[model samples]
Target: MRLQTGANNQDKEEIKKIAEWILTVGEGTAEGNNDGATEIEIPNDVLIKSEKNHVKSIVSAIFPSIVEHLNDKGYFEDKAILVPTNEEVDSINEYVLSKIKADEHTHFSSDSVCQSEFIDEFEQALYAPEILNGFKVSGIPNHKLVLKEGVPVMLLRNIDQSNGLCNGTRLRITRLGKHVIEAEVISGNNIGYKTYIPRMKLIPSDKRIPFRFHRRQFPLVVYFAMTINKSQGQSLSTVGLYLQRPVFTHGQLYVAISRVKSKKGLKVLICDKDGKPKNTTTNVVYKEVLQKMKEDTTF
Candidate 1:
């Protein structure tokens, strides 16, 4: 389903900025050997949070489109769609469901299903393999390892080049001391002619599972616990960071604040006059959260 947007021009600007940032323009030259590999200790807490948030974001962004297409074809309100069981999810299941717009509106479930399932049903499409010639697609895009036998490697994917179509995707991963892999890249098709990610690091999460998508609306409650000290190194475009002295750390606060690309990307929660952590969290969106609170509380 096509998203009718009155703010096409505005969205184009935002998209352009996002693309540019991802491309890493004006970034430095590529560094280190082409073949490198190392294992870094995964911070259990950080991985848990990052993976969860990353997956949920991807799912929310992609699922709506799938649902919209399905609804347009009269799939919404259909009874044949499988409803995942609680048992299936706990022991051997990791399925999730949320309301979405297919063409009109519907519910989509991610249970006992593989990426191929979505593709088979035309719910989603993969980037043409040919377009990703230089990169390998032996497994799912994120599944393949970037290094082989302690050698650095690349993962290429099709990306929108500011100039025109690129030949392929190339992401360089080099081994650093302490079992770390520093990300670097050389690509003619997309952003950054040569960029050395000196501090870029990857810490595998438990099970080495890649992030998956989750689609849920706000007022939406997720059943997971969150802690602060676990977050470090990584940055986020948007985040709602919570802090409470003893349980929280300065390092976490710093990382959380830096994750956002700009001031518009952060939200902070502070205690109130009553000395209680007064649910005073605010997002650094275009509008102020305090104004929203006033409006929300006025009635």
Candidate 2:
């Protein structure tokens, strides 16, 4: 499969070298091997990075065009807005739900059984909202739930991968029940097909917290917006990347930009700390990882 990007000269050269090395290694024939290895070639324009302010410009210049394309394809009927963190996901979900006039918000109920008797009051207090907020800042499977028919959502677990109901799979709610939700796959091979999602017990682990707690809830979240990390393995038809904060980790910016199948389907909004538009964007790439790959040519 060919992966394209809009990267600058430096990044393009580095990516090209990496892609060439991968092709060479994969197609190299082993000693005493009778069968010839399958040859794979990397496309010349496989990796491209958007120029500085390119994404912002595209979003501004073609906002209406992109919206028209989405509307024509019925993408807006079901879509995923990719963000950078869980907190942002929750915040955006709340905002979208509020705007749509959906008021039903379900909070997860935790199991009260204590696992460790050694847990003191201080350690137990870590699970409280005031304390847990500090730790739950970046975890998975959100504790709060909001359901609205026709809203897009993402599965948090692998209920059935072969059937396209897996982690990061996007779906639109067809029916919402107290114990189960019926949804139609909107972005996978099973698009237009429906599936049933049931409430399940979820345990979140954070090193900052001393004790663990289990919360029982549906394994899904409003995918109107989701963290970029959670969107790694999924292909989105229409992607709105809201960068309220600059991405801090390596490959985050790349991953976020590359989620959409094409540039026409992408819309990026980069905001400053004060939520205003910003001209420049920050990209974090660890060059050492590339150096290591170059040094280890034996593979």
Candidate 3:
């Protein structure tokens, strides 16, 4: 299911636009070599959405990857301004009512819109949006991409960078032996001009003590949710997207559907009023890529 921030996010028209933008802009280019062309297109008719359930597994793993890639690529170049509909207004009212119930000290009238507006005003007062673009995503590349028992698992380590600071390092769990797995750290933390490693004697699967820093040493692990806006700049090998109208922007629909390397790699779930995949627009670009891939791979 797609992530919704506020009640207004359930709009379908807006979701389609955002999805389109993602399809075109998110998967536009890549870092490595594979014909340094400006853009690439996959075949049409790849069955991006099926009547049956064939894309379940691939969807589970790919959504996170797609989100990370987009953040790396700087998809959130512009701000999204969302206007609420009547349905959204009602939702906000319901939410406000619930909040009022939770805090018995505050009294609220039956007017849902008034309560909702008051809550929105209070929340909006906290932080405004920051304008950002073209920032490299660190830490992700440090994690190793390896397989354990035929299942791929990304292994990461928390390493101490001098002066009470620690950065998590990562390695792939390559070959699992009786006690350890053969692995190597792909990336390490950089402090000032020097780079450091797990030089104190370490092996894969070894449970080491956490580094201490200034009475608190290591940096806390932080997780951030991926928004459709930030995901516009990535090129995903495979993608599973949730569509809703509330987060819509012009070209956003295009962005969401076109991230996959091929149509076969794309899976989309369109949520209805009941929060199920009952209402969804057919992804045109996904179909196009699928058709092309089949013809090329055909013997």
Candidate 4:
């Protein structure tokens, strides 16, 4: 049985465009003038998306060789942005922080002030700290902020969409502060532009929790390695896709591979049963979804 994944309105629009493109191109029809025939120009966004997918496929094919070359040049760990599963984010972050002595620079402790009109002081004492500490241990905005200048970070909220300070936006910390931080946009159109990020109150949606609790913290995380879901919609100069376990969802492998700007910046490391480096990986694609897209052109 095939699972149905819901597509957003934008996705449906893109599908319609692709279907029309396919129908127009596959039928071998061209708009003709009196003197000559003119071929349809593909949309710039479509061309860029196609080019990125092509580069990703090529990079995935030669990932091992790319990893070897990167290691030889001593550019794997320090420079490249590592993308891994959520389970591995903490371990990798800890390893990278320790290697760089991130603690020596500056540490910003998140102010976890309990703010709720419903809960009293005694009740707040029981759930607020416990829940907030749990979030910290689980790497939700992190407990202790050990930041070093020039380290990569991922924005946790959509602070400014116009300036490209959105969720999952990658940046390098330029200056640390008590109430704010100066960071330069490392990816997207706003690259090299510096912006200020301030600590804000963030509330988690956990249905199991009986009381409401909000944690005041900077909406940023040390992104030495991030989850594939969080790495979506952002392209990196270099990507190291470290697979401790095989990806279990559709489009995850595709998302991870397509994060790099070029084939030269991509590397994949798969771990075997013994947790050693393996050369092969399993890629899961729901073929039925593609078939559905081809069958349904009404979008």
Across 41-118, the per-residue lDDT of candidate 2 in tens digits comes to: 222332223445433332333233432342132454434666777777777666656645444646464443246436
lDDT of 3 by residue, 1-299 (tens): 13122315456555454444443443332222222123223223332343443223223333334323332212211111111122332232233223222222111111111222233565443322221111112222111111222111222234434432233322322234433334333223321222222212222221241221111111111111133443454444445554433334333445555444444445554444444444334232334454566799996
Decreasing lDDT order of the candidates: 2, 4, 3, 1
**Which candidate number has the best TM-score?**
2
Candidate ordering by TM-score (highest first):
2, 4, 3, 1
Query: Candidate 1 at residue 52, lDDT?
Result: 30
* lDDT of prediction 4: 0.57
Best of the two (1, 4) by lDDT: 4
Q: Per-residue lDDT for 1-299 in model 1, tens only?
A: 01112336656666454334322211211121111121112112222122233334323332234334431322111101110121211211122123321122112212222333234444233323232222311112222122211111233222335542222233332223223333333323343333332212122222443322321111111111112322233233334443222122112223343444433334443333343443322221212433566699989
The model with the greater lDDT, 1 or 3, is 3
Stretches > 4 Å off in candidate 4: 1-84, 101-126, 136-140, 205-211, 292-297
Q: Judged by lDDT, which candidate is best?
A: 2
Error (Å) of candidate 3 at residue 186 is 8.4
| Candidate 3 TM-score to native | 0.28
Models 1 onward score TM values of 0.21, 0.68, 0.28, 0.63
Superposed by TM-score, candidate 1 places the C-alpha of residue 275 at a distance from the truth, in angstroms, of 12
